[model samples]
Target: MPVAVGPYGQAQPGCFDRVKMGFMMGFAVGMAAGAMFGTFSCLRIGMRGRELMGGVGKTMMQSGGTFGTFMSIGMGIRC
Candidate 1:
């Protein structure tokens, strides 16, 4: 009687490893694309977007400062 050979095992990463690698690569690509687009938009559109964004950013900063001051004062009252 002839002896039968079993299936050979492959030396490679499993399906999950491939999926994880793909996700990491995709995330890096997305970040690079976002950065490129942001730069392009900033340069091509002149100061319009920058002005609008700056105004909003200033408002947010002022609001945050006011909130922090109020929180500190409230804490001081208790201590």
Candidate 2:
């Protein structure tokens, strides 16, 4: 069974259902993106077995600086 319409005659994604769907979609997209990028990096860098693994780790860790820097800037603007 499924809801045909909400009380307001709107579409029937209830609050919890909407939240769950958002999370599910986000997770799916994230997994697909991660796999695509990981494959690209592995191919693009062209490293040996151990070096390839290390390169991927190093590359992913590098994004933390960019994230932290932007976060601080946002906080600064609010303060």
| TM-score to native of every candidate shown | 0.39, 0.42
Count clashing residue pairs per candidate: 0, 0
Residue runs of model 1 more than 4 Å from their true location after superposition: 1-10, 43-79
- Model 1 scores what on Cα lDDT? 0.51
Candidate 1 similarity to native, TM-score = 0.39
Quantify all predictions' global Cα lDDT against the true fold: 0.51, 0.56
lDDT of 1 by residue, 27-63 (tens): 4554455445545555566746667566445544544
Per-residue C-alpha lDDT of model 2 across residues 29-76, encoded as one tens digit per residue: 544555556557887868778877666555544443344445445444
Error of 2 at 2 (Å): 50
Cα RMSDs of all predictions? Answer: 19.0, 9.3
